[model samples]
Target: MTWNSKLRCFFLLWVLNSNIILASLESEVSAQSDVKDHGEHDNEDYSLERAGSFDQIFKIQQTYLTVQVDQLNSTNTPRAKDEKRRLLKELSRAHGKWGDQHPRKKLLDALFSYSRYFERNIPDVNRWRQLYNHVSSKHKRLLDRTVSYTKKFDRAESLLRQNHFLCEDVVNEALSYYEIGREELRKHIADAEKAGIVADKMSVSQSLKHIGRDWTDDGVSERDGAFPCILDSIQSLFPNRQSSRYKVLLPGSGLGRLGYDVAALGGFEVTNNEVSAYMNIMYRFIETQSKKDAFQVYPFVDGWSHHVTQDDMFYQLSFPSMTMNNSNVILVEGDFTTVFKDSKDKFDVVITHFFIDTARNLMSYFETISSLLAPGGYWINFGPLLYGTGPWVQLALDEILTVTEDMGFQFVDGPESCGSLTFPDKKVRNKEAAYGYSPRALTKNAYHAQSWIARR
Candidate 1:
């Protein structure tokens, strides 16, 4: 009787425990499903979409590089062999010293061709490990397609694999910046994970190509075409010039050159706001430099095309040709609209250099600028309307001026040429501004950037 009763009680206990475990498992799965659902349904997906989009963004980057390397290394087809011969011929012409016998030719082959510069100790590229483990099946297509249709770049071949080194420069710095950003982005992802919600991804991917030359003295001509005009307008339009330094907002201040220039020139408190993590870390990198010409930049190492000479093709220049660190300059990192949305009338002047085109909706940017500037504050813009990527409304110059005026601004007469090259369309004074321009390069991507002085 005792054995039968004890066996029945043990069976009852075991059955109850199994049911409890089943219920717990069901609850956990249901909770995960609910979180997944929220990510899909909510505007801000706190799910796989948001969390995994930027996860291993470097995978695409590296894959693209690998694709490029493969292209340069490929000599299978007739076209490839012809291309190789052509490149060797070009190299032969480049340096009477460019031949195989030259010391630098051998050195460059070791430095770029065979070196693990893009991998190994590089912190930015290496940091992808954290994000690499999270790319869900959904976003795998992005990684797959980045280099799928990518063809050999229509560039001159480099016998020593020197053509794409410009990409290497920017990628290293960009990935380094990505490392800094990755840490911050992980924080947001973790918070969302704890809350079981999808978080918004970090900053949009911005081209970091300019980062290579942003801090260099080679960029001085580009700056002269814009920065001096920005300062002149600020000094002329701003009141109480001698009394106190006026707050000037410089959005898209890459590597802090324009902002530092204004601060160094005196009479202005410069706020350098940048969105690219690449630029921010690079700026911080420059800020830490104790001496001038601390770094070297090869702006044209990638420009195998559009070059008349080997010197132009393989020019070497020092970064920060001069480091003008001023305490008056403060950098704010984030989107222009989001960072200063609430700060109405906070700036005495707003200067945009090659920045207006950065907006998809120029009206939104104008509104933000209007709100940020106090009454009688001036907005001096110097940049061509080269609307790039995304859904940018490519408005004609006349339309832009009209819309800008409609956005509650009065164009004040200024200099005939803001800096260099003038465009005569509207009565308002405007001019062309060049960015990343080097006269040394046979081909230049100079822009007739419209310049204007508008009062809010």
Candidate 2:
């Protein structure tokens, strides 16, 4: 409110305006100079856009739309933003400029389908897609082949870049397409009123395998290699086939298939535990289904890399190859370290299948595992050292055993040769094994995960 302060403020604004004016004049002079200095070709018409030929314009349009749709995928989180919606709307209103061969419409449709299904959620979309995969071999091939031709249209980097959307305006258009899948996912959740699925809840990059790799017949091969160990341990401890004699706990039981198989084989009270809501929803969904191998999964729809053909991405797998109605298998849902932490001297056998490395603190897991087992209980583990997220203490095989021994447990049996992951001085004659993988996939993840059977 003082004269001096008002004068100073006016002076600053005047100086700023003066500088902007100067910059504008300088830019104008530079443009004029460049035009004057051009060679003799400058005498001819130099209008850039107007001078282009029909073919040039066509190419421009193709590239522009391609880049526009490509840019629409700059993010993968959500579609509530105004700019993203505007861009998609602008493209949609373009009046079908591209010819029949052009991929504008196809790309647009694909993106739309992705948006609607995305509302249902990624795991839901894939689970819904299982319907397409399970219909028949002939139809499955068609869905597989279609991806080969449509891969380049436009997609984000996740899930093979399958889902991206521009606006909520058009999201409803594809609802009918997505609703069938929505209902399927809902029904799956509705089917199983109780029970849960195992999940680490990592990003899609890590969790995608839960649905894609955990249930397939190929995935079963990994479990098949580990199952015998549990059976052998059980038989060694209690030779009789009593219904409730021995108590076995399986943590990180994705899809509950491993536990299902163990319980199906009979003789022990088996408990399967998991933490992922997505997996839990699907598992419960499978619980109510009647047909064996009726559920299908096309998990690689977005996993375009390390695949030879589109069909490779369409690698369909029918799940629960043989569903057993086992009443003895118990579904316990919660984190492994906390759910049964208060209990002591309970479990007869604790099984870990590709699960031990999921711990952040190896000592805590050992402590928990040790606390749960009876004095003569067996702690059987088979998995690679693929440690989960951080603040984790990663120990070598020797270091892990040392820690296990420190937890008031005695080491027994061999780190023994089984899968390709076991690295003993002498080569073992076991078959090459993978946790979860498609054998024909270009990138091979086959490894001999080390195996061990310890006694408490």
Candidate 3:
């Protein structure tokens, strides 16, 4: 009787324990499912119809904003006053249309509000209490613009939080990213003041456009295909990756990611050349001086799409601490052509990406590379021949090749097409249209983005 009662009690306890375990597993799975659903909702791609209909509208609004800003800053004549009134009206209309309902509209409203703040806050002569307290009109204007623009970025971050399309964490990261930039700029300004030079003309705003991209690894999907190709070419030339230490030049190295990778992995002495001041500053900061454990930024941070939720909108970006502190990675800031123009055959490999188009003269680039590389040096190039210069100066791919050949460089490998370049949440395709936009011009006109390895 005791054995039978004990066995029955044990079975009852075992069944109860199994039920509890099943309930916990179900709850865990349900939680994961909820997360997956939120991810999908946030990351949904913009529909074709929505993109086609609204992308043009977004572009128009952006263009209008740019034009209005220009007019506001122009000569202060009667016409200029009228232009200001018109600009304010346009901003009012935009605010009225969507208010905070749309993230992009909210951003525009923030921008317009800041512009008005700038206009109204211009210090008057009477405001100066003492001679030492007096500020130059130029310095006042610059301060007003900087503070106002910084506020706009702050406001944009706030508005973006209201929209479910993007991640608030990412938005905050971007805001912090810009704030860091602003602080870095203050140091530069202080240095300029100490030297008795005007730093207001540095155009900090213009340098911002591409700095975030370089600070993150988000653009790898579009532009990183050539990284492997270039490495392979260089390794083949040397064969012994561990023993051989080759001299490498990365011209127009935006953020110097590829160059950094080459030096770290290929055991090469790499020099990364970037011409833009802000880009170089940010890149160098991340490469050497970034105080943060890891830096994060949204690539193509400005562009927003109607097709996807804010969550799926920005590419989640972070650059790992692969700085290769032990490796010989140099960051040089200057015009690539001019910097290496007088260079002898000092470099074993020269790598260029989305850079050749920045050249005013394509022939100049060829000549510079030829001079910079050794007799058997390899020049690895990726990116289209979009002709950054005027149409008159723009040369076709064939013309570029002919000039390189004339410069005593022969093909080591390929002009092989990697793939068409496309940015995250952007309508523009390829490096050309991304940089320059025209509704009349086709976006995907150039294709078969070939990577070439030319040996001198």
Candidate 4:
């Protein structure tokens, strides 16, 4: 009786344990399935289109606000005053249009008006004092009331706007005005701090001169010697006799050495376009200095041509001011990317030295150069493409070449020339080694850079 009873009891216990384990496994699988389903549902609920649309609107608004604020904070000369008024009018109109549609619109409109008023009138001590007194008199109550009202409107608008996801496009447009208001507020603070502080004109002029000459070897002799080499390379590509009265554009003309040299060549009319206002001022200063030094040093330099006559000298401080010069130098101050915005196949030669690598938008520079070049016109670009900045230099080259060819320019000369020029940093024996160089360098970091002559 004892053996048979013990076997039956053990079998029953084992069967019960198996049933319990199966139940637990089924429960775990069901829980996991529920979790997966919940995650999928959550993902579907958070629509990417909705979030992306909102973000786009937000950014547009931010930019608009910034521009409006900047305009308000700008110097209020007659032109600036007119611009401010126009901007304020536009802001008011936008506010009026949106205020009726959205609750936050009124608050946003008030903020815009306040910004304009502050920017336009705060410069007057009397006006500012009056404003301060008014604000101080009703400080606690008015501040609380304004804050509470704005919050309420903001919440209401947010709730209403969320339901009308289709109106994301409209909301995006309103976002621009909101951004303008915000940016103006920021500029108002900055302009307020800068008020009454006049910049030193002489110091600014000197700083400009230094910046113009910064990239070159600082010694007067070195810069003077370099001019002949630069002109030789320039003349070799486009011979002086055949070059005619070619319209030459030299951008970043720090102190106008290259432009002055080209002009002095007699055949080519060089226009110097310098971005820095200080550089332009310094360029004029140098012209005066050149006159003073002309008798003493002009005859010694063999290549120094007198073709850059006083009558032939022309300069543009900024891009827009650059006059179309067929036989004279045109100095233009502008972002090279937008240089040819209105150019009508006018230029015959576009030359830049040590300008390409320094550009932030390398492709834009090449692209602009290609666009500015007339048919059969020469594009001379000489610069260090790859320096200490590793992959970025390579990427810039790729972008420049890609844009150059895309804009219908053909590379006509070698970008592979290897030569040793004196390093700007004279302290460094191995220039490449000084800038964290490895043995397996992708491009040469030698003192002398490669030159490319392209034709469009």
| Local accuracy of candidate 4 as per-residue lDDT tens digits, 7-47 | 11111112342231112111111111112122222222222
Prediction-by-prediction clash tally: 5, 7, 8, 16
lDDT of 1 by residue, 1-456 (tens): 110101111111123422311121111111221121122322332222233533222221110111121112211345334333433443343545555454223322222211222222223323443465477655656654663311112111221122123223332333232222333334433544576642111110122235444666566677677777777766677546567878889998877777877766667877888765445544644554434664444445433468676556556666556644545676666678876664443887898888888897777788888889888888888778788798457788788778888888888766654743345545455555666656676666777667788888
Model 4, residue 139: displacement in angstroms? 61
Q: What lDDT does the true structure give each of the candidates?
A: 0.52, 0.49, 0.45, 0.40
Error of 1 at 218 (Å): 2.2
All candidates' TM-scores? Answer: 0.55, 0.54, 0.49, 0.40
lDDT for position 69 in model 2:
18
Error of 1 at 189 (Å): 16
- Model 2, 1-456: lDDT tens digits are 110101111111123422311121111111111222223332333222122341221111110111121112122223213323432442342544664322233333332232333333445445545554557777656755875322332222232322211111122222221122333323333333233422122333233355455555666556556666555555665676765557888888867776766665567767777754334434544443333564444456545478786557656566555543545565554578976764443888888777878887877878877788888888877667777669468898778766777666775554233334244442222334565566667776765566666788
How many residue pairs of model 2 clash at the backbone? 7
- Best candidate (score: lDDT): 1
* Model 1 TM-score on a 0 to 1 scale: 0.55
Which pairs of residues collide in candidate 3? 42-312, 46-307, 165-309, 165-310, 165-311, 166-310, 166-311, 375-456
Indicate the worst ten consecutive residues by lDDT in candidate 1.
Answer: 1-10
Better of 1 and 2 by lDDT: 1
Clashes of 3: 8
Alpha carbon deviation, residue 436, candidate 3 (Å):
12
User: In terms of TM-score, which candidate is strongest?
Assistant: 1
